[model samples]
Target: MLHGGSLPHLTPEETLAPILSALESVLGSARPVALHQPHFAGREWDYVKDCLDTGWVSSVGAYVTRLETALQDYTGVAHALAVVNGTAALHVCCLLAGVIAGDEVLLPTLTFVATANAVSYCGATPHLVDVSPVTLGVDAIRLAAYLEDIAELRGDTCYNRTTGHPLRALIVMHTFGHPAELDALAELCRRYRIVLIEDAAEALGSFYRDQHVGQWGLLSAVSFNGNKIVTTGGGGAVLTNDAALAQRARHLTTTAKQPHPWAFVHDQVAYNYRLPNLNAALGCAQLEQLPDFVSRKRALAQRYQHAFAAVAAGHIVNEPQDTRSNYWLNVLQLHPAYGHLRDALLETCQARGILVRPAWELMHRLPMYRDCPRMDMSTAEHLERHLVCLPSSVDTGSVDTGSEHA
Candidate 1:
């Protein structure tokens, strides 16, 4: 069994061989193991069929409300408003957090582009920041230091000293379903008087210090995309503890219409971002199996961890201390010395029908965000180069945690 200690002396291809074998051992020689796939073994068909049979398949139906209530109960939030998709949910969260035009929102550069895009939707600039290797989310400590040096408080608003734009919100994304350090980040938000918004798109089942990930933020968003742990085919929700904010979220997402039997009266300019009842039905079913899905995925991660334990080239990225991750995507981060082999390893793994991928390109590197203001991206850059997302579908084979290796 090849191990990390021996990796430095081996060629790129040699180093990749053990990693590939480890993945194959755990996932079997299943010709096309997807990175992550939705598992619908619950009441999916039954509920969806109910929607179809009743001809109540659009946005305004019982299923939508049912799913919202389910999410609120599961996540322990006071309210959850279903929307068209995660992006829409995030946009609404931004709006609810008071992120207006010309404002600057702080978010990690390592997050999915949607996090940055949501800020842009509010006509706000995404001020990219680095992430912590521990959480694969925002580095709250570094951010506090950076903010202290570059931000100044004017009354209750935090403004970028250089750009002169108000720092209205800080988005903390739970990368790959691992909860970020919410307590620290929340404190930073308080000291700076900036609103905290959680991009919990991949963290539906994740928890931080016994509480759900979305609870720390004033307003947060959860995704139910086809690839997520809980799938609505295509849907999302805005979560909040404040009843007033929840009421406003519902109004804004539903096009800001005043309740009337026949009058078509809209009070403000809002979005038609309602999640269809059909999708909500599916979501309700998926939410029912979230616990099982999270369990299976976590077991799969443990298998990968043990399999790669002897592989000195790299190791699995586990949940940070005191946090419970959904393990939405199992990650294998190559040792810094072997970072150059990352592309080769990805190519080899894909060639063998074992699907794997690298992390998202840092947000600031994108063409549209090329000129966006950013802090040091050294950590994110390093993570982007070395992180490989392994097969993490709920149906993947699991191994006993007590075993030495898969």
Candidate 2:
């Protein structure tokens, strides 16, 4: 409701108190509430029990295969390989993308650290880019222009002439479950011959123009971490439509074992990043309840939107145009004038037993990535100052049927 303009604000306490009270009522407790947590309203126990009863709790089991099938079906991607975590999936994507030492992986600066860390794990430097104020994802227009101004086309590959490093791929994060401008970004990648990898870590059920977020890029990674829309405790998946890329991902993640009945033979130096069967069992159950979780989270987002309509200081972050978000983490970006109140609001909420968190510091600001090349990060700086992650756990089985039942 506080759209595109500043509002006349009272004191910070006066402004945030009502919002906290509203949250307390919705959450059904004055006790501390987590930002996000796993919800097991379906057959999670039964699936895990099956793994336990069959004694197939490790990497090898029916559950792992079933989980992959569920992901492939839900996401409409041809191939899905379950891995240990989202970071593992990203690292594998880097390897498969042909990113080598001294290569530069372009990504948005306003995302979680895992995206940059994954690029670092591949021995490539991260090239942080600006994000759109509205979408909170990379800005395609700016990215294309930046590439043109600083990059060169050396035959088939694009290289950042400024840094003298080949630009291997563009890693776009679907920030907070809202699908980015995939069509524009994909076209840019094509023009520059840059491989595209979608870090749909928070966007398991999100879509852009009816196409799932993870299905558009050359390869994508989805996280099943506890905070994501769907949780496998500690699991993730790599998704791609290309059979060759999918097969390569599977082989590389499973330690490149040359299939032999009992031979200890490995064809290449690979990572043991396979998701454990126990986690996959949990993932299978979570996938079954994903639709319901998505629905309930959207309902909560609607409630927050309506509430924010009455409050002038906060604007509820919603799905961007032509996109359907899972609303994984409900967000509010305070007006810049009131951005100074961010710390006060966070502390106030946490003291009142509601856990609210600010966005991560820009990757370029970090010491490890300080030297990485980047374009203007002004928009990301604005976001880092204003945005806040609110409580958005699945409310399927909440005890309090109050406003949270929205």
* lDDT leader: 1
RMSD of 2: 2.6
TM-score of each candidate structure, all chains considered together? 0.96, 0.96
Q: Model 2, 380: alpha-carbon shift in Å?
A: 0.6
Q: What is the per-residue lDDT of model 2 for residues 197-240, given as tens digits with 9 covering 90 to 100?
A: 99999999998999888877899999999888888889999999
> Which segments of model 2 are wrong by more than 4 Å?
1-9, 400-406
| lDDT (tens digit, per residue) of candidate 1 on 207-233 | 999998899999999999988898898
Badly placed stretches (over 4 Å) of model 1 are 1-8, 398-406
Model 1 scores what on Cα lDDT?
0.91
Taking every candidate in turn, the Cα RMSD to the unseen true structure, in Å, is 3.7, 2.6
Model 2 earns a TM-score of 0.96
